[model samples]
Target: MTYTRFAIYDAPSDDALAEFGATWLGWDIRTGCATDQPDVHGLDDITMTPRKYGFHGTLKPPFRLATGTDVGGLQVAVTEMAATCAPTKSGGLALTTLGGFLALIPTGDLSGLERVAGACVRALDPFRAPQSKADLIRRRKAGLSARQETLMLRWGYPYVMEEFRFHLTLSARMPDQDRAQWFQTAQANLPPLNEIYAIDSIALCGERADGRFELIQRYALTG
Candidate 1:
């Protein structure tokens, strides 16, 4: 059995992402939905991927398990970790352009949200398996800065801790010429992000045989 660990999201349920994904990305890229598609672009298409998983920031960053790690033990640890952290009550987010693609980003005070995300990343990092040589090479293709490279070397992912940004993606990258048009369309259709969006829980997601993601468990923050 193969397993990949995700920080779990608290946004809309699996069904929601699937429905929205079909309309937004022209494909149903969520697990358990009537449709499923591969993540052909990987992190290159951050906007669409996170939205398909629903809204939530990454904490431990997803990873495939090492040969010896126990899946059950990892799940137990994740549940315990979630129980100790309190939910964030930052103001709602807004739809905006990030690196030329559409995303929903925090609008109001986000100190609390950042704190929760950082804590989760640090606490659950022990469970992350090291990146493979191919993975490392792929990450390096982004021409990471020194800090990003350092984080990648230490955490098996380039963006975390100091480099974290809370966002839900909406599309693939676009050319500069088309950016304005895309952004306008995205802004028009997206929900108003200015309201307070609560981060009450974290979800555990799993990849299905067809390469789409599915929610396996949800852990609410009790602290």
Candidate 2:
């Protein structure tokens, strides 16, 4: 299958959590197919934004491939990189509102996860095609700071490196009044969240022609 863009993600390894994500989002990225959503009020509308990408935290945002790069090379390079890194232990995950959206955020030390995300951003950057003028303009319209502009120029993305905050997004930007209702809904539907969240592997995902991202492969951090 041809993919227009690709990204790296830390997808859930736990079966129940993974299933809940797929069902709730109404897209099973692993299977590259849509799933039946749970019976919840306004669920489809709420999940529309994140449904296509499935449930995962971004390690590297989507990017077009560079002129000389190919998926085969990306796979090999990512595998090598993963083999050299150790897994990260997120003290635990908590569901909370972020920038008007609901997401699951890590509550523990972030050094290990930061290192992994940063390495992926830098090491695999050679395969990233330069951002187009329109893309840059669109991003800047969000009101970037000076440091973000610098990061954007150097890394093809601004919210990376020191700016990275790992979160598994669960909803689109909600109205102020609707936030509490959805938060309660999410908490009631989600699986147990008290267990330590481990970032032991990363998945390579490809955005299909339809704009939905599908899993390519998952590389384990064996180091």
Candidate 3:
């Protein structure tokens, strides 16, 4: 099971994108419910891990709050952060293979996206609980480099800073052949996100006891 984390996630801005994503992943973040998903051999297995988190790009990789911290205070901080950060414009979107898996990737203006993610990771870190020894050991098992180990110790997660890659995960690991098949299916069936899109909002999400993450709140970026 994935670690329980309080993450900043970029949720879909519209219902069409939301429904398409939920149907593809089989879990709706807005409703906290499972919905009808695509039917295909091994579709469930392919999407198992991502389905638990719903459709989101990790802005701040998950972390629990420090002792004596409260969720209410966290939500207030997120709202304040969004208020000062202007919305970002993604040049467009694409569907492609990312490390043996499928995800939605931004085409250009990535520097803007990077700023948003970095801000969240830095500004909200005061609330984050330190990584436990068990978690640190688990990350090392994934073969982190010296730089990655350094980032892990500093940020409580291995993939951050220069290592961060913004992706809205579509599936777990797949064979080369299976990846191609699903990519074709997704490109043909999912809603087209090719035109310019705005990163107008951010979502605060919390992991549940059952390992699924639930939407706590969504704050619009107003600046």
Candidate 4:
């Protein structure tokens, strides 16, 4: 099956670019891997495991399309979907700990963002391939809540709508002790958090044979 994902990307500013480069260099050294991990939050002891998928904040979860569903149709739907969603206002982002890893999550009320995300996921659901048995088992391994299970069955992903939290991932996962060190390192290296960041576009990404995600379409929020 073809692997694909839909996500919203923070358009990189000059500062963001430089910060990403520096953070990646540090993570590469810490992980002892030649290539930098795709997400730039930070790599700590807990999240040092290598993931085949590259980093991105999921907007619509990944799915393989049904046999006859064309890419052109999906593109049109995604574009239309994006055009109807309004951008987030007032709330800014902060580097915060999620479970075991540090990430940039929106601070304050984010019901608007969640609504947009949910609408996008639902709007595009018709084109998505039904989950395979293996996919369901893999999802079950995460020990989903009842609501998440309902979401999974209805929308092909568990984390959207009320479950959504906007975050740009930094690391795989890290231990509690290493968390402070990593957080400090990341805060020092990342772009300043005080700036107003926009969640104005969703990027369509595809997985390559080697399993890294590459950008395909970047749909702007026009609403």
By lDDT, who's the top model here?
2
What range of 10 consecutive residues in model 3 has the weakest lDDT sum?
1-10
lDDT of each: 0.64, 0.92, 0.86, 0.64
Residues 1-223, candidate 2, lDDT per residue (tens digit)?
9999999999887898888889989998788889998888799999999998999999999999999999999999999989988888967899999999999999878999999999889888999999999999999998999999999999999999999999998999999999999999999988887568899999999999999999999999987
TM-score of each: 0.80, 0.98, 0.94, 0.80
In candidate 2, how many Å is residue 192 off?
A: 0.8
Best by the TM-score measure: 2
lDDT tens digits by residue: candidate 4, 1-223: 2456433333333355424633443332112224543453444333444233334456776677766876778889888988888876436678888878777776777776677677777888878888888988999999999999998888777877788776767666776888888888767766556555556777776654545455666788887
Off by more than 4 A, model 2: none
Q: Candidate 4, TM-score vs. the true structure?
A: 0.80
**RMSD of each candidate relative to the true structure:** 4.7, 0.9, 2.3, 4.9
Candidate 1 regions with alpha-carbon error over 4 angstroms: 1-7, 13-31, 34-56, 192-194
Cα lDDT for residue 19, candidate 4: 43
Count of backbone collisions within predicted model 4: 7
Q: Which should have the higher TM-score, number 1 or number 3?
A: 3
Q: In candidate 4, residue 130 scores what lDDT? A: 88
Count of backbone clashes, every candidate in sequence: 7, 0, 0, 7
**lDDT of each residue in 1-223, candidate 1, tens digit only:** 3545454544443344425444454333334454333343332354444444544445556776655766687688777877788888776667677887777677678777777777766776676778889999999999999999999998778887778787766776777886677666655545434366777777777665555556677778888
Q: In angstroms, give how far residue 190 of model 1 lies from its true place.
A: 2.2
Better of 2 and 4 by TM-score: 2
